[model samples]
Target chain A: MTSNSPVGQDFWDELRRTTQARIGLGRTGTALPTRRVLELAGAHAAARDAVHIPLDVERLAAQVREIGIGEPVLATSRASSRDEYLRRPDLGRQPAPGTDIPESGADIGLVLADGLSPTALDRHGAALLAELVSWLRDRYTLAPPIIATQARVGLGDHLGAAARVRTLLVIIGERPGLSVSDSLGIYLTHLPRPGRTDADRNCISNIHPPDGLGYARAAQVAAGLVEGARALGRSGVDLKDRSRTEALGPPSGSEPGIQPGHSPRRR
Target chain B: MIHRQQVSGVTYAFDGLVEVMAKATPLRSGDQLAGCAAESDGERAAAGWVLADLPLEVFLNEEIVPYDTDEVTRLIIDGHDRSAFSAISHLTVGGLRDWLMEMAAHDHGAEHLAAVAPGLTPEMVAAVSKIMRNQDLIAVSAAVQVTTAFRTTIGTHGTLATRLQPNHPTDDPRGIAAAVLDGLLLGCGDAVIGINPATDSPQATADLLHLLDAIRTRYDIPAQSCVLSHITTTLGLVEAGAPVDLVFQSIAGTEGANAAFGVNLQLLREGNEAVRSLGRGTVGDNVMYLETGQGSALSSGTHLGVGGAPVDQQTLETRAYAVARDLRPLLVNTVVGFIGPEYLYDGKQIIRAGLEDHFCGKLLGLPMGVDVCYTNHAEADQNDMDSLLTLLAAARVPFVIAVPGADDVMLGYQSLSFHDVLTTRRTLGLRPAPEFDAWLRRVGIVDDAGRLTPFDPTTSPLRSLASAVAP
Candidate 1:
């Protein structure tokens, strides 16, 4: 059998060990080695599972209660079923009827929803919220985490407007990938409402560890973002994540004029 | 900066102001044949591979960059170390072209250049890919639509197909059905008579599907139709029992990009299964149709970091592979030039990307096709698509989309025209999917020898009705 890993196979292996990219998974007898192929197949399954597996919302709610941080107001999006959430994205953004909320306004409306990767919330949702709650508990009036099922970043708008908060801090699971599945994202919007577009928010992505920001650091950045959005009068392209050195993709502040967050228009 | 404005009234000198509007011009479209020599069956067959074998990869170069570039050559001799590309990190497009041409001469032009460039920028490799003519790697994978007695495979040897895009200004069925008849008269609709509905409403999309389904049943046309709207809308249409032969989705390399299109792998599978479960694939199991290109990962911000190398195009290609590998699509199109010159500069770039994407998609074992198209605002013309389409045909590319009169009024771009399909069939001895071919023959559009004869549309049933539906 002929090896397709190039002549200096060891050198590529050395580089491979340093990063998670699919660089040096050497080929065996024309195709990828069976072991590596299986490994990839496993990774694909894990990523898909991260997306398809329903979140233990009860477990997540219990953890939030145990932490004694923020309170809880549970709700679902217009997408009642998992199938609808996956396809009708617009429904995921609109607030469903009968969401229990506080009539009085709060300083900050904390919303935790399942983004594309439910596993992200399963792993990091409780911890990130606890830290965020710990930091902002003294300075501002914090509402409980308004748990939403099948939610998008814009879902926080409806909750925030209903809660009558000056700002909405949404910590949701970001879309999963082949290498890193389960990374969470935080979107902060100033005066979020039902009709507010993505242009009204700012995103700090990759908010989990190993390849993402740590929970504490992510919380620290979220706090700073809340402060900045208040000072700047708006979010979205106006707000930026400058509390620390960036880790993945473009940092928040660099985008100009365009809606630098997730695409607002549905395809 | 010199501003060439013929203003004799006053001499205005401005420093650092070019007065040029900053626009990331959109990508161009179309694959057509404005001029070509007529040919007989034997003559056309002799010119190119008329009976080309399936899944052929003639241009498989094991050594991607075999030229005497100091960086790669050093790596070959220095026992392979890091920083091999440090000395040659950035080069002009011309400089990159020279190196690539030298490698192409050595029969080793398969280098994945994004593997070693700086993370933020990898345009040189992108430019090189756009320019390199991957003539060696020709491939063909075909899909068939079965009828009562026989079946015909699309992209088989001696065949090409086109999707008739009948779009309406108001998402109204009247105007759209007219255009469908107009295209069918020109020997189009072999690929699939699809529509790009003007609105995004699920009801409208589904209604268009039902209208087309009724038309197909009424005419007894042995062809497939698609409403190239979002898959959710298509799924709704399918559940409503509309005759949806193909469910369409615009796919990107990364999962995030796909989320924008309301698509995930699971949903894609569900849509495919839904269509299959309904027995809608009676003609073929080729159910799902996908559209992809470079830079979707970067644009969607889901592109993984390749250490420090540029990851946009490479990651995007792999992402397409991931989707294709999972779904086993009936048709996959890498709309190369649709993204504009900012991503792909000109004809050379568009042509090169079309081949690379086709090669990569086929390598991932999907039935790959090319939407040889460009946007009106892009820096391209029909001449560009003409060259690209001809090369793809010569390479025996499996399938391409077709529009009427080189213009898709609905999509607002030009694509492979009915003229291009006729040219491909006449000049390369390529035929349409067999069932569609038989339908065309029965309509007396083509003779028994499979040659398209001059058809008097006034005498025909549907083409004449097109005049009523059309302006």
Candidate 2:
């Protein structure tokens, strides 16, 4: 970042250390400096490439099996191709008709899908699944993990229904940003079924490693949400993530009861 | 009435008004997804030709979204100013286009356009936009100006404002403060200092609102602050005495789509009344901040038009302006390209949608701004955004959203940066909102002539802001 006054450089430096925001970039008559412009271009190139990259489902399944969570079951969303997946979101939320998924009726279901950023799912999916399953298996019966291709967040609903699990946790790659292209996200839904709106799910996003949410913290948050969902008999807007406030425990002293659905708001 | 046209010995007939409108819309991925887009360019041209010949009064008679099913439609039909419409009462859709172009070219065109703004329906506005070229949209939009005020006046000629979006992934107060300080040094945030919280919890929203209020009051900056949360969250916060300058909601065109958003006309009305009753304004009481986008209705599975036919996304987007106009919002912007590539596939489609939204909103009498942005998955880059930003600036859009470096870490999208805004303003000889410009000079962020001074963060008056949030 260029500073017009060299004296202010140190203060800006101190401030820049606090946030991920690009704060101190020096301007050249309303244009960004040469390096900053090129930096953004380079970042955008990576992110744009990440969106089109396909996840290697066989490799990801092998990686998940190595983690010893459960036998990885291969699956595909109704969207046959990436182009179709991007255009028709409705198709991405459902499993392809007649696809076989053995129903174990386990207490928890896990699905690893290649969302917008398959590269992210390919890179971090196994590690995150391993971390999250460690916190989940001892307390609940785990079903076979489903590896979904060309999926959206809602794909978990169909896969979870097929598994007949009480709760579904979808660990997927989030849409890439210029700053962080490989960030992963976890979505939790209780009693997963079709027709459940975003209100019926709670999201834990931006979980890449080192710089983003570390694996331990992300697993902790997911376990907390799973526990909260089981206690409340539901998820979505009614369930709050108190993982940051306290350790996962009983629902006593926590507001875990059915409440009316709250509307979704975003920028 | 049957809508048909002949193209090279081919008879193209549409099922109804909605079908005609949909087929005539500039090609976009959203309409194609909905199975309503024209099958060929010849069909689209034929449909446009038919749409142009339809009388302006057809909008008054035909409903795109059924009136009984959608309150937004009811608002347009009920609130239409017939007296104001009398000026253009006899014009066809094509006639209205020619008239607008002629008036825009005249010295006194702005007055004529403003005079009839109240009479125009969103359908009429959307229809004319479908027939107009990008340059026509720009020229007509530039001729019309709609202004609003809270602490600063916006939409005055020779001025462009920005909504400083200081978002953080975890809502860390110190991180937010740093970004806000950066924007202030660049003379941004003249439209409003708004935040899109990661979570919609009322408590978190209230805390951010409080943080912004504290900064706004401490520096006595001539601007308003908003925490964009659900209307219910904002309403509860208002009841609990939170510092709310603007009540925000992402409204849609149809009642079902809005209901999916967990909002309705009544809820918005209540929120508007609740925020206004707080008496938090120095310049005016325009407290509502409304946002709309093209594909929200279709995304929600609620974009039905006449005979259950799918309405074009752009028409649905314009109908949202009817909702915004009724609320008397201080700011109404379409988060144009934020919905991803499914709706607006590429740079050409995104730019066209941005201009169309701004044009329709201005013609319908709203202080419209555009979030000139794109998601990474969308086939767009910084160059696309630069093109859109320059075009919108040329159209004299009331405001644009500006992040620190065009990368919104929290929202995970790209938008115009502070430097981008400065570049547009300097290149176009525009200033910030009047009060914000005065405050900038008073605080030494800009010179006496309202030009940005070399920012010296160490001696800057805004150093107090850093210290306040400093650990």
Question: Tens digits of per-residue lDDT for model 1 on B337-446?
Answer: 76544355456767766777765555344567888976532445667787888777776666787754455544445566666666666677777777778888998877
**C-alpha local distance difference test of each model:** 0.59, 0.88
- Tens digits of lDDT, candidate 2, A161-246: 87899999898877888887897888889999987778899887778878777888888888988999999999998898776554
| Superposition error at A123 for model 2 (Å) | 1.2
Native-contact recovery for every candidate? 0.02, 0.65
lDDT of 1 by residue, A156-247 (tens): 88888888999898888876544567878888899888878766778776777755678887788778888998889888777876675546
Candidate that scores best on DockQ: 2
lDDT of 2 by residue, B311-340 (tens): 999999999998888899999999999998
Kindly provide the TM-score obtained by chain B of candidate 1 when compared with the true chain B: 0.68
Considering the two chains of model 1, state its CAPRI-style docking category.
Answer: incorrect
